[model samples]
Target: MTGIAILPAGRDDAFEQYKQLIRDRHPIEDIGSYLNDEDLELFRTTSDDDLVHVWGTSVDGVWRNIERNDIALVYHDGAFVARGQVLQLRHDPDLAEYLWRKNVEHGRWNEEIPWEYMAFLTDIEEVNVDIEEFTELVGYDKTYRQQGFTRVADKRLNQLSGEESVKTVIADLTDAGEHIHPVGDEDDGPTPDLADQLQAASTDGNAHEEFEKLVAKVFSGLCCAADWIKREAYPSPSQPEAGGRPGLR
Candidate 1:
């Protein structure tokens, strides 16, 4: 399922980074200078266009579900200022260091937090979407404010779109010439107390087993072609295979 990613760029430094990396396109030849041979090759293969923009985040876990073709909404000030489609994603600290050097110069770079999770984007469009209207369409609270890199799950989008395609709903909402009908709040009501239910579920003896199954399910969806293997069969970097270096099978 295609998803939507909200990227917050309201902070002064973040906005500057956005202007440099996202608003303006960079030639692959120019960016290639900062990448290693392996990364350069990977970037070249994934990006068919000569010019592209890179968006990165230091936050963990938030980017795991994002995939190619996901819509990226760039939020700044009180509105969404830009939108684009993610073409490629990578986690390369070396490349990120070069791209966000201002963070380093400002002494904001830490070994623990690095802007390494990247999304290469194409077909970018400048947009003007007020937060209130956007939140209404997505079924979020009218006062909802994006705090960080956030993903609106496909399930949530599917619920909001009903029979219509999520992509069509997103396109219409973001299009300047289009009009959006506010989602009805007739079903909205007092929140239900799930404390007892959560406590019972958390105390289940098979919780760990259930978690393992859930992890496997998510990973299977992410990499359908990946081979399932036992932990013993996984190669360690220190122990290379007979003919080749250690790597996933």
Candidate 2:
């Protein structure tokens, strides 16, 4: 997969620094010059790498005063082969393992994130994950893509907070006769206790009525991440592997 590595008009050394840092974690100028008047907070490399590359997703407004926005590393292979949020990036082994499991994300992410992910971020603060740090950990966890889904499912087991909310939304949708992807053993395995808990929570009859409102809230981040990679703003710089590569997506 490919993405445009925005060159700040002419900062060649800065660009080399960008590539070298990604390749070697060497120190480089944190700032660089752009075309007249507009200095760049960062620089770009000569080309985008096939295996990995870091690119700006959205810039923060305040950083806009001096280039604010979140930028993150994107993965192409391994379990974490999914389009990810810079904020979501973490060094925790467990979370890293979880992310690696969802990398390809049902094979729907070979395409870049849609521009829509850019819609909700209000400022640069939202994009603050350190790209340099994130890139270093890209494929640290060695599992294959199947692990990503397993991790998400495993996460469900201990999700005291999100499950009730998910169950409420699911129950509401089920009641409304609204068609949604059925929560199957494939992803949401049968857990009688979880089901019982879900049933107890379903007492609120309006959950069905509030379905749309609920999806709007709970699906915001997930959908935004999906939207970002699906849009034109994130096209691969060159022709992508048709149907995408395996083991990742």
Candidate 3:
């Protein structure tokens, strides 16, 4: 089931950070400049224009439950100000430090635990839904105020039939029904062609090279780990089997 994560973008400093990171999208090149090779590669695999946001270790437990395609509702000043679909996640303190070091230097953020847990998001849109209406929709008390990052409890969403996800409920409340994609309904049109290509390649004389390419393609598609996969699959091009690698670069 697709989950919904409530991200409290508090007033003042926190809100300012939200505006800088989530509201105003950062250039990928700017972001890439700060990342180490490992994290930079991960960053590149996301949708070209996705927004990447982060949460500190305080919400690490809650963040773990947030999966790909989950709805992330940004709350601030008694309303959901924005929403987006999660595309990928990473836990890298170095990258986080680079992104939010300004806040730390200014004493706004805790230096002890940086916002290390990153979430790459797409389909982001500005929204405005009163807390009362939002709480009622999600089965929270009308007076409830979110204090931290959290996944809406399953019991609150129990009213939804098995096929329905949190995305459906939020869409209805915000009149964004047209933007909701059904849970688990990703477009897989290219999967068959990829499989066919892999099969044909496996029968070629260079079985080792074909095998490595197959692994790279599969991992790249599955987890957006194309760079990491290529690095491991072709660590040194000096090997005869690593010659003429295609489709990865």
lDDT of 3 by residue, 155-237 (tens): 76766624444565677676552323221213222356778777887666545555545646576566553421122233333
Worst 10 residues of 1 by lDDT: 181-190
Query: In model 1, where do residues sit more than 4 Å from their true spots?
Result: 33-49, 102-110, 176-249
Clashes of each: 0, 23, 0
State the lDDT of candidate 1 residue by residue for 90-170, as single tens digits: 888887877676432222455678888988886678898898888888889878888899899666788878744565577
Give the whole-model CA lDDT for all candidates, comma-separated: 0.67, 0.24, 0.64
TM-score, model 2 to reference: 0.19
Ranking by lDDT: 1, 3, 2
- In Å, residue 197's CA in model 1 sits off its true spot by 58
Per-candidate TM equals 0.63, 0.19, 0.63
| lDDT, residue 142, candidate 2 | 35
The alpha-carbon lDDT assigned to residue 67 of candidate 2 equals: 21
Q: What TM-score, to 2 decimals, does candidate 3 have? A: 0.63
Once superposed on the true structure, which residue ranges of model 3 sit more than 4 Å away at CA? 33-57, 103-107, 161-163, 177-249
lDDT of 2 by residue, 39-121 (tens): 11122221222122222222233212222222222222221111221211111233222222233222222123211111101
